[model samples]
Structures are given as C-alpha cells and as structure tokens.
Target: MARPVQTPAEVLGIEPAGAYHRLLLRAPGVAEAVLPGHFVTLAIGGRDSATPLRRAFSVHRADPVADTIELVFAEHGRGTRALARHRPGDTVDLVGPLGTPFPVADAPETAVLVAGGYGSAPMFSLAEAILARGGRVGFVLGAATADRLFGVAAARALTPHVAVVTDDGSYGARGRATDPLAAMIRAVGATVVHSCGPMPMLRAVTDVAVAAGARSHTAVEEAMACGFGVCMSCVLPVAGADGATRLVRSCTEGPVFDGTTVRWPEASPPEPSPSVEPREVREVREVWEVREVREGVRS
Candidate 1:
C-alpha cells in the first residue's frame, strides 16, 4: 500500500557542508514507508505558488524508531534556496516515500555505485541495505572539484573501495567519473552496476556496463511537478515490452530503471538554424575586404 503524504514536518536539525545541506525532519507517517532511493517533495512556506509547490529530494536517512527522515539537497534553484533558509523547530510541508527503488540483489553479489554531485544522496541508504544483506559494494564519485564532492568521506566509512574523480584534477583522477568507473568494472568484474548523475554521464555508464556484459540500473532525474502519477509532467521515452517506444512516468513507475531497456539514439552532427546564413557565405565578403585593405596598404 502507498504511504500517506505528511505535511508540516517539524525540523529536527540542519547540517550544512559546502553548498549542500541536510535537513532532518520529524514526521511519523513519512518515517514508516521511506526506503533507500525513495524521495519526498517538500512544499516550502506552505505556499501554493508555482515556484515552490514541491521540490523532490532523496531520503538521506530514515529512522522509524525516532520517527525522523533526513533530506540532503544541494541549493540549486529557487525552491532549494528557500529551503536553505529554514532553521530547526520550523514546520515544512512534505509528501512522499515515492518512486520505485533499486532492485535489491536476491543473493550475494558484487555491486558498483557511481554518482555525480548530489546524485550520491540516494546511494548511501542503498549501500547500507546492500551491506546488511552481505553484498560486496564499491563506489565511484565524480564532481567538478573537490569542494563540490559531497558524501565521499561518509561513503568511505561504509566501504574501503571508494574512488574519487574530478574534472580539473582538484582531487582524484584528472578525468570524468566514467573513466575510473569503466576501469573499476573491468578490474573488479562487478556483477551489477548502479548509477545516478546527469543524463550524459548516465548514458556513458550504461554503454560501458553493457559492453562489459554487466547488468546495470540507472536513476533518472527530470522535471517533476507532482510527485504522484497525476501530473504527467515527468514523462520520459522508454522501450515498451513489445519493443515499441512509449512514454513512461518517472515519478510513479520509476526513478530507477534497467539500463538495457532504455533506448539510446545515435549521435548526429549539429544542424544549422534556419534563420542563420551559412558561415562560408558570411566569411567570403570579409575575406574580400581584408584582401583589398592589404593591397591598398602595399600600394
């Protein structure tokens, strides 16, 4: 059965690190059903405005005994920035424990988790669940710089096999996370790969895992208005069971999906805009004028 949405949750505490923040909330109903990889939509200020209707954030931690749920989010846009203004003992409206979770391995298996930026939020709980079931786990985290890499130290506490990658060589590897991830999968022979990041990165991980003959799953992020299935705003194209392409709701059906089932399109060259003239045509007159000027100067 679906859990009821809880609004007006009391803020238990606030913890800030770099650009990211963790808000611990006490809401009895939410604490019961929240699982790893599940998310909640928070309505800031209890307002009905379009900007702050509800913002979805992953469940960083859930303690049923204490009736508390923790949400770790980066201050990205308007809604999140507003959420950052909140302090302890304040009330915030929320709705959730929504979306399908990553498939739990039925047996002992090697699992690799890859995350980019704040995408790491959902994987912590997943790692804990896997560890409890005696599953072997490893992690690969990627960020633009070391300062942006949140939760790497905490993740290391759970597993020793953690690799950090930064784009500008500020921390670990001087390349994207996909580079080390592919290397790790090859060396460790991971049985299953789970990833959450930007679409391009997720696509790259999917390709690498597929080529290596490893089963993989991905958590996709998209614009979601309503956390429930009613809004239909978070639809994404997916291959149906009949091999035909159809749109699926990212909110209800999944934020997590099998990588193999997704259809990736072939790369194509950039198309010129209809309103813009050809570059060669524009450069021809400029070249003629430059040559005339050069001849005049010589004379």
Candidate 2:
C-alpha cells in the first residue's frame, strides 16, 4: 500500500492492435509501488485539453528496473479515440498505482486464474507474483475468438498448463472458460480462484469456486469518472461481512472484492461505471488486434 501519485509518463512505445493498442511508458515511480491488480488513470484527450475524466486501466505490468509500466486498451469513443493517437516520446497524465491488489497468499498453494479478454491484463502480473513465491498457478482464459484471447502466449510461458476457451472455436477449445473451470480447479487441486471479466461471467465463476469449496476473489470492471472514490460513479452492490448489501465504489473500496460477497442483483447487464464505454465493451466481447512497434525508428 504505497501512497498514490500524480505524474506524467513519457510514452516509450505504442503497439497497434487493429482495434486496440499496447502502450509502454517511462513512469518514474509507478512501477516501484504498483502490485498485481493496481491500476492507473490516464487523462483523456491528453494533458488537460478538455476531457472531464481520466480513463482507468489495470496495471498490465510493472518493471521496476526499467522504471516503466504497460497498459493495453482500445479506442472506442470521444475520449479514448484521442488517447489512441498518442505517439512515442509524448507525455500522458497519470494518477495512481491505485485500487486494491489481488492478494497473494503467504503460504504456497495452487491458484486458478480466470481472465476474460483484457481482464487478462492484471492476471499476468498476478500469475508472475504467485509463481515467484514458489506457488503454482494456472490460467483459464476465454474470449469470443482467437484474435481476442489476451494472454494465451504469456500464460503458456508461466505454466505449461493453460485452458483456452472461445465462443467460436476460432482457436483453443470452443466454449465458455468457465465451462471447464470446475474441472480445471479439481484437476489442479487449487486452493483459490482469482477472476476478472464481465459481471455475469464473474458471478458464474464465484458459483463454481464456491461449489468447489475454494475461496475466490474477483477484480471488477466498472466505469469511473475518477480513479478515486470522489466521483461516486462506479458503485456496485456487494454484501458486507455482516450480510448487509451496500453499494461500494469500485475505485477505492475495490476493483477487487470477495467473489462470494458481491450481489449482482439480477441477471441483467452490470450497472454502468464510468469505465463502461463502447471501446471497452467491444474489447471485452472480443479483443482487437495489436501490433507492437518500438522507438518509431525501428521497423
């Protein structure tokens, strides 16, 4: 839990995905303090031009040695379309290293990481952390098709065991990631499940984990006008320890919460959080392509 900071990061590179981009930056102290699941807010339309709110993105990766961080996102609307135009060497406003991180157990135990699309962003860091501690972790990644699967290659490097699911059989197994989740948990003898994705998908994951007697935690995706709690726009109903349901802000109280305690309320689509925009929704449905280009001078 390090204190948050507001600073500008010099964009080092941009990888163009047909529909999204991977931005790498030289962020002074961001990587040093960031942990798995922490996110940063980038000012839309760049360095105070007129956009009212900053966009939040999970910390995809942090390299303390390089003093850098990476983010993956798609440009969907007015604000993000502007964000997508940034070129290397430019500066982007950032406020964070914010929100709760996926808690890694001190003792070694097997873990099952479930990610949907860019939800895979934070999971890569979490998986790395878990493995660094000599614990075992597996990935269960899903998307609409092969082009959308975010971390299959990365997950494979971390562990030989990865289960990939897609709605359309474009690649990997054809089905929901959770379709094989229960069996994956049993096969791996997992002690816990960590998940992130659409609300309905998360709700399903919670149920599967609970039935398996495994503890579960989920990183929620909500729209946020502010990365801090002040906006009051990212609230969701989650039951408290005493069993009383209260609306909580995803920014401060959590983007991460006990899976079992969340109350999605109905089978309806998740409530809108500021982060809920067209680009994100489409990317979540299925990821866009990304083409990594470094230094501009390089081919």
Candidate 3:
C-alpha cells in the first residue's frame, strides 16, 4: 500500500466514452502510487462551491510514465457536470490512491472480473495487473442498454473470454451479467472472482462466485462525503474473518472487500406491522367527537 497524496492535478484531456466522460489528469505522485482498485477524489465546482465534498472516481487508468491518471464517470449531478467542463490546461485539486485496492494473487490463477456500467473503469487496470502477473483474465460486463455498457473492446484486448450482457438486448446477451458468471468461471477454471457494480449486482456476483466455490472480491460504490476516512460517511457493515459483522469505513478499510465478508442488506419484504388507524382517520374521528360534544353542550 502507498500513502495517499493531495496534489493540484492539471487536466490533460477529457473525452466521452459512451455516456460517460474519461478525464485525464497530470498527477505524477498520485499516478505513481495508484494501484488497480485505488481511486482519486477531485474537488469539484472550484473554490466558491457551497459544498466542500470532493467527487470520487475509480482510477480508470494510471500512467506513471506519462505522469497521468484517468477517471471515468457520468455527469450525474452539479458537481460532476462542473468536472466535465474542465479543459486540458485546467488544474484541479485532487487526492489519490485512496481506499484499499483489489488484491491480486501472487501466484498466477484463472480469474473472472465483472463490471456494471462505468464500474468497468477500475476492472481494466485490474485486468492489466492480473495479466502482467501471468494470471488468466475474463470479463463479465453488463448494463441497462448497449450504450451504457463499457470496456468491451478493452476487455477483449486483454482476453478472449469477455462476456457482455444488456438488459434491453441492445448488445450481447439479454440478461444480467451475473447470469453467465457461474458458467464462465467453471469454463475458465477460475478460482477467484472480482466485481464492481451496483449493490444488487455485486451481491449477485458474490452469490454466484460462492456457489462456484471461487473466492470473491467486490469494490463497492458507496457514497462518500469525504473520500478520506474522516466523515465516516461510507461505512458499511462487513463481517470480519472471525465472523463478527461490524461497521467499517469504505474509504480507509476498503472500497474492496471479500464478497463473503459483507453483511449484505437483506432484500426480504418488510414484515407487516400491527394494524393501526390511519392518521387521517384518527384526525377525522377526533373532529367528529369534538362536534358531538359541542352539540351536547348546546342541547
């Protein structure tokens, strides 16, 4: 692990990737220290913004040689829209190589990496790392539609086992990405699974990996008010190796965690509570009682 750095990174370029934007920044120190699953936080809206929170994005690509790092993100709010407006020469204050990165196996092993939407960003770097370490890599990428899917070409460039799934059948298979994960893992003889996506998708990936008897690592997309560990905003319940589920900060302890270790939020329907009068009905009944008492007093 490397110490995170806060530096004023100059924007090198910004380009569109499907519905998202790929931002390149000149931050040699942060780029050099970044790992596959590490992310960077940029101060958006400049100095006059009301909110002081920084926007966090996974490190899509890190080029220490070029002294640059890339971040991929969709313009989801005012902050992101502001970031998207940055030009090549603009300097943006950023903190990087934050959070726990995906753990790569020292020994070469067959592995499957999964992504949903722009969550594919970090997986590309992770794939590169795995391949460099002589590990076999396969990708399962899914999104609501074809335009929403990303990194299909990038994944194919790394390996021939890339699987694409779209909810609308716009491209590839018409289903969730996890639909093919178990088969792919078995086919590839993968002993490990890595995933980054929506919580439900990650949960499904985790379930599939566990069923396939493969180790699972998931990078969560939790909202962080502070990209560092200060705010405790990105805390989630995760189980320890000892099996105790406790709150842990995603910023420091992890944005990546053993899939099995996360105490995933239960999806079960809420139990029916004891019957109670509606507020409106109670209020109407009270009004009726008051009227009756007034009539009796008049009588």
Score every model by TM-score.
0.85, 0.87, 0.88
RMSD of each: 12.0, 9.7, 11.4
Q: Which stretches of candidate 2 lie over 4 Å from their true place?
A: 17-19, 47-50, 266-299
Query: Sort by lDDT, best first: what order?
Result: 3, 2, 1
- Residue-level lDDT tens digits of model 1 in 1-299: 14657667899898887668989999877878877678888887665544544788878888989989988888875678778988889988888788877888767777889999888888988888888888878899998988778789888899888899999999888889888877778666688899887777878889888887888898877656777777665665667788876556778877887877765342111232343544334333333443344334334
- lDDT scores for all predictions? 0.76, 0.80, 0.84
For candidate 3, the per-residue lDDT at 98 reads 94
Give candidate 1's whole-model lDDT. Answer: 0.76
Q: After superposition, how far is residue 73 of candidate 1 from its true place, in Å?
A: 1.2
Q: Write the per-residue lDDT of candidate 3 for residues 1-299, one digit (tens) a residue.
A: 34888899999899999989999899968888889889888887668864456888999999889989999999876678888888999998898889999998788888999999999999988988888889898999999999899899999999999899999999999999899998899888999999999888989999999999999999988767677888665667777888776767778888999989886763111233444765334433443443344334334
lDDT tens digits by residue: candidate 2, 102-127: 89987788999998877888998898
Residue 243 in candidate 3 has what lDDT? 79
Between 1 and 3, whose lDDT is larger? 3
Error of 1 at 223 (Å): 0.6
Alpha-carbon shift of residue 199 in model 1 (angstroms)? 1.1
Pairs that collide, model 2 = 16-291, 17-289, 17-290, 18-289, 223-273, 223-274, 223-275, 224-274, 224-275
Question: For candidate 1, what is the TM-score?
Answer: 0.85
